[model samples]
Target chain A: MKVSRVASVFAAALAAGLIFLPLWWVFASSLRPGNSFVENLTPLSWRAFLPVGGSFANYEVLLDGDFARALLNSFLVAGVTVVLGLAVAVLAAYALAVLNFPGRGYVFVFVILVSMVPFDAIAIPLSGLFSTWRLSDSYAGLILPALANGFAIFVLRQFFLGVPQELLDAAEVDGLGRFGTLLRIVLPLSKPALIGAGLMLFLSQWQAYLWPLLIGTSPGKQLAPIALANLSNLYSVDLGQILAGSFVLSAVPMVLLLFFQRQYTESLSTSGMRG
Target chain B: MPTMSPRRWRDARLAVLLLAPAVLGMVAMRVVPAVSAFAESFNHLSLRTGVKEFVGFENYAYLLGSGEFHAVLGTTLLFNLVLNPVIVVLSTALALLLAQRLPAVGLWRSLIFVPAAVPGSVTALIWSTAMQPDGLLNALFAAIGLPKQPFLTSSGQALGSIGLMLAWGAIGYWMLFVVAGLKDIPQAVYEAALIDGAGWWRRLTAITLPLLRRPMAFVLVAGTVGSFLAFAPVQILTKGGPDGSTNLLMYDVYANAYQVGDLGVAQAEVVLLMILMAVVVAIQFRVLREERS
Candidate 1:
């Protein structure tokens, strides 16, 4: 028993260290000066994962460069996508789950199939079509493609199914129209699902690389990933700036995951394993 | 057929109103692009001239006959063949460990789970820097008195290194699913196994593995798809490498379309990739179903 307990503790620590170490290196490297970033890592010691002579100058340089605009674009685009995606998805999910409409089964099946079609596979032709319509290099180019998120609808519908049928019927008897019942009753009950669905939409847009790479090619239209990617392509690669940009790009999703830990886990547990 | 009542008419109208935006958006965006990709693969399109010429089987012939496409197909298959199983096994092990009554298990779980949230581009950036010759990974190797590795630089090891990077990002996320599956298993089964004097290994193989089949199947299929679609890491880290060693099919399609301006070929590659995915998913379902019965 004693031996097993010790072994389990050691395993936990090792697993945790594997993740924490790389992240700490990125965070520490982001703060350190460019030249010393490489120096600290060699002869690996605590100094490598710790801040030594760290400053905000790398961040200052990054923000002053095009990275700030890229960050803004990602935030703006992700924000719009979440609000619009959630509104669109929630309404559709409500209908699919609660209403009696002709061809409901077919519509439900269509949503599932849509969810299965990998976005990355279709991006090439989509980009060509977007550019032809003069939608490339605009916010519409970035946000429009992601607005119709079938995964969000699928998740929201699953949650809505769990709502008591009697409760919805009672609401109907109380003279609540379809929209009214959805807004007043089902919406309030489905907060966690809403947050989860919204998070899914937001993260997909925020981390989008290939679509943004294709459509948002102009300098003003560049998203965070593209901006960070461009840093290393320079003739003289700036390690500190790259690290700094990476830390910022990575931090948002991690923070969101932490903040909504319960809802996120619940969301994954319900929908993710279904595949 | 029954006559439509007033409430039935109201419900139908409401349903249409509620579903219209999402349905239209999906049809315009998801369904159209995919159908057009299949359609466009059969034609030669010039963006500048807005002229599309019908060229049946030519693009497919050009792509399939090319040595580069074959190598890309091989690399993609080899990478996923190695990557998916390694991830499933390692993550299952991690899930089993974390499921134990270890100290501060929540903290450890969160630490591991946090990386799944890191963006793919960010993962590429971090790993690209760390895998440098004088970078942090090498520094750790030096600390232990081991020889340094040319991780991303060597053609021989570059694909495996990319696999390792992807695995590192993927395992923790999949571990959550397995852990959830583990939770669904009744403790009574383990207790009964213990009463029968079954060893840990026996219990794992007999009880846990069999019961956890669904989640494992899910992890396998989803993880395989993810490996197939992996793009940002290759784009940022190698750009298909020193001699196209790291070029997977998705990036190959991107290179052909964007860098080389050959949409016809790219669409043909997309069609091939989607067909491959469909076949793989279908096989997985059949195999998993057969095992269950």
Candidate 2:
């Protein structure tokens, strides 16, 4: 029994190392000075692990370029989308979950069916509409279409369904109006679901490449992912600069994930399970 | 009873207040575009003429008749059929292995998940770099006394390489879901199996597999849907190159819309792709429901 326990411990350690060591190497290499990637390719020297020749020149160069503007654009798009998506999703979800209305099941089914529509298929028609409305290459163009996310509505509705109906009824009996109850009671109670869904939406928007790339063709309006992708010069290939930009572009979502890791994971799992 | 009239008025106002934003947004964004797309699919539109002519089923007929469209559909179907099952099995296995009471489990989880945080474009760039002739992967192969493989350069290998990179990036995220599912299983089941002299494999097959049907179903559907719609990696890495081996339906739609500026053809392809996705999702749900019954 003790031997088996020891074996399990060893196995766990091995698994953890398999995943972590490579990541550590990448992070360390990203922080290392020029030519270190080439230098550390072999011999496995101890000097490679140290910060003796490390510098933030890569980051400095990246931040000085279009990276800052792209970062801001990412924030603006994701931030606005989250606020708008949550407001709309919460309202729709609350209505469908709690209210006894005509065509409620049909609405639920429609939302789920729409959720399966791949964004790739829809992007062309969406772009055409944007062109007609003269909203192309604008922030409103990006945020407006994404605000009608079916996944958010579906997840939020499921959560609202699980909220005890007795609490809602009690609120109604206490002279609380529906909107007031939703604002004060239901919204407060559904914090976990809201945050989870919000995180997922924000992450999706932040890492959004295709739609943003398609719509935001202009330099100032492009998001981080798109900018990082187009950061190459006309002639020279700056590996260090590219790596630095990639790391910076990746940092936003990573930080968000770490902060809301629990909520994000739970929400994703719940969404999958429900689907 | 005296206040019923006022209460009814207030309820009407409240309902409108709650439903207005979402309904308006849905109409403007989803409903409007969807209707316009359906309308546009039946019409001829082009940048050259800037004219719209009604052509019922003409766009669809053209798309169906195109050899490229047929190839794209076949590629998408083949990619999904192969990629989805491979990812499901691998992700499930990884999840089961990691879900055991393991030391540094959090570290392992973070490592596996960090790649997911990387932008899709960046992932494509990294893989493209790694697939180069003198790249890290080739170096490792040479060190291990193996011949170098032209992973992305070869027509036959390009699609498979893109598929592998996608699976690598996605497996961790899916594993996280399966891990969540595995956690929900009670420990007592395993404990009971231990008392019955059941080995690990037996316990897994009898208890774990049966209990994980819902999550498995979830993975299957999600994987199929996601793979069917894959586009970015192909765009960044291969660009559907090496004689169009990597041209899936989504990329084909992209080329039709952007490259060729054929909105009608693009819309036609979009409609077809949606139908395919709907069919897959419907079949999956039916299978899951039937199994439950």
Identify the candidate with maximal TM-score.
Answer: 1
Clashes of 2: 0
lDDT of 1 by residue, A67-169 (tens): 9999999999999999999999999999999988778999999988887888988898899889888999999989997989988998899999999989899
Q: Mind giving the per-residue lDDT tens digits that candidate 2 earns over A17-43?
A: 654443344455566654355465443
Indicate the docking level reached by candidate 1.
Answer: high
State the lDDT of candidate 2 residue by residue for B102-220, as single tens digits: 66677667767777777777777666655667555675666677888899899989999888777766787888888988989999999999999999789989999889888888888
- CAPRI-style quality class for the chain A–B interface of candidate 2: acceptable
DockQ of 2: 0.46
Clashing pairs in 1: none
Residue by residue across B177-215, what tens digits does model 1's lDDT show?
999999999999999999999998999999999999999
Q: How much is A195 displaced in model 2, in angstroms?
A: 1.5
- Chain A superposition TM-score per model: 0.96, 0.91
